[model samples]
Target: MTDEKNMNHNNEEIIEKAKKFFREIIAENHVKNTEKLENIKEFKVNPFTHKYLANFLTGNDDPKSLAKALIYPRVLGTSITTSFGQNLQTFVNTTLEGYGSTTTGMDIEFIDKLDGRKKYCQIKAGPQTINKDDVTTIRNHFRDVINLGRTNGIPIANMDCVVGVFYGTYNDLSAFYKNLAEDYTVLAGKDFWYHLTGDEDFYNKLTDAIGEIANEFDGTELLEKTINQLAMQLQQVDGIDE
Candidate 1:
């Protein structure tokens, strides 16, 4: 019993250490992204800077203030967002190992060399909001791939295009899939996870894993602590600059 308890404690420590490591990475990236944003002419002179600075000086760790300081700048049509997107693609790649490699011209790509087949994947965070422009873009890309194969005398008939969305209440996405050709597939929520994992209940397991993590640590407290650290760093920088 004592040995089992010690093992559990060690696992908890490992989890907490991993969480802290990721937090530090994100915080370091936040600082780097802020520097990049400051170089942009429009962002440099943006009125939001004054507000964010004022909030930081006041030690206000409000969610919006933290977002302005950390997340907003990173996501502002910059390379930071693109880099983050690639990181997320990597996460999916690691999670779906033994599947295939991530290829260009799509968000996630899978090549099955054994069958001379491939799956071009597009991933979105949520369901029920399929962008028409993105659909058009993907369709054009697939068309080009097929056309390219025909020109080279290597007919690629086993190619398929797919979209995977993270979460939604509704399971039926047939209406959206119908917009594409018969070779295309649209999967949402659990169906998407099942397609990738080949485990019908993997979605539930994923959610349960998330719940376990939440139970292991207080995410809210960690987030607040990070915001406080960011606020202090910004304040120090302002003092030095002035």
Candidate 2:
């Protein structure tokens, strides 16, 4: 029992040392990129290391900060993980092995090769469509899985785990994308002529009205008539209810 205790203590010391090393490396990287050091937190090199790192990089470390960052495409649009579908299976295998997890629910679906490059594999979640709720659940699950792996001394790298997290996020958000498409279609259907109103006559009249307004105050009547006509035309074309 004493021996076991000593071994466990030693293992913990090793983990602490590893964590410090990782923290320094990450700090250096952030510094190189002109990111403020205060913006970076100390690194924890556990199974969930990548998840934490990804979260930090993506500005998801705090709920409020994440909400603000979500408005613009920062990490989501500008990370290696965004293009992870290009090599799905390899990423999955690497991440799973890194985390030392018994491959649970691991199935690969083939997506078309992009630009004649890598053949993509989409990691399937289950036999059902993914939704927004599923996305939150899966992301949490991934964090748990990765942290478990790290605690076990699995020797998994951050890169391996990050790839998996990216793929998982992508799969989970698929439904959201579908919903967006449907919503766009509905909106477009409601305002069909909003996009189709760019006729030569419309452009000419608009230009003439603008010139008249700029050139003469006496053009107010003409401007009002032109504006009313344009509004009527747009309302008619868009099928708007009177």
Candidate 3:
């Protein structure tokens, strides 16, 4: 009974540590994103005009989508999803250093708290970004990291590799991840978070934090203004009515 209690206590501490690391990344990125938000208007829109104009010339007659195209580079501070995955991995590296785990300076290398084995993960914001060709590269990376660790004194048996999908469940994962599944372990959504800190809800908990950040940062004023600007630009363009 005493042994079980100690294990539970340790698990709680690990979960708390992971949460603290997530908060640090959120706070740090909030500042950086805010700064980018200030200069939102300056982001280039020239490319979008040409790209969408071509679409207009083709079959896409909807001028309304132009605003969305503009928003990608301007608002949301240039792909928040992409930034979140990178930042999450980064903060985890920091936590690994302070915690019992060691930072391997690779993609996302850390020791799993639940198991004594070390994990080297290729963290992705979502499964959609992975392509068929990326599978081979991912596998090769794992092999290389294992060899590197062996050289550094960590045995091959003591280490494992994984493709950590930041969001979505296994069933929801894209077909591209099919190839990866045949090789190394692929943990997604709740399971992936559990693998990291032994906390199943870690994914949801931190993602809820991200939602709160979105609520705080997803201002309607700028969005409406940008859309209005794009609408006028579209009006200037010769609209093709189908």
lDDT by residue (142-201, candidate 2, tens digit) is 455456557987543222221112212223434543443332211121121111121213
RMSD of each: 10.2, 28.0, 6.5
Candidate lDDT (C-alpha), each: 0.52, 0.32, 0.62
Q: For residues 1-242, could you state the per-residue lDDT of candidate 1 as single tens digits? A: 99547644543443344344334443346445554432222233235465666477556645336434553434444544444444554545444434443344556655422333566667765554456776687677767666766788956552466666765534454345547535666667877665554456656766555445434444354444545555555544432221
Runs in model 3 deviating more than 4 A are 1-105, 149-153, 239-242
Which ten contiguous residues of candidate 1 have the minimum total lDDT? 37-46
Error of 2 at 4 (Å): 44
* Runs of candidate 1 exceeding 4 Å displacement: 1-87, 107-118, 128-130, 148-159, 169-183, 220-242
lDDT at 49, model 3: 64
| Higher-TM-score candidate of 1 and 3 | 3
Q: How far is candidate 1 from the true structure (C-alpha RMSD, Å)?
A: 10.2
Which candidate number would show the highest lDDT if scored against the true structure?
A: 3
Q: What ranking of all candidate models by TM-score puts the best one first?
A: 3, 1, 2
Q: Tell me how far the alpha carbon of residue 242 in candidate 1 is from the true structure, in angstroms, after superposition.
A: 22
lDDT of 1 at 103: 48
Q: Candidate 3's residue-wise lDDT over 112-210, tens digit each?
A: 657767777777767677877787788777777778877899765423777778778899888878667876778788887777766666777666654
Regions more than 4 Å wrong, model 2 = 1-101, 104-122, 125-128, 155-242
Q: Pick the candidate with the highest TM-score.
A: 3
Q: Of 1 and 2, which scores higher on TM-score?
A: 1
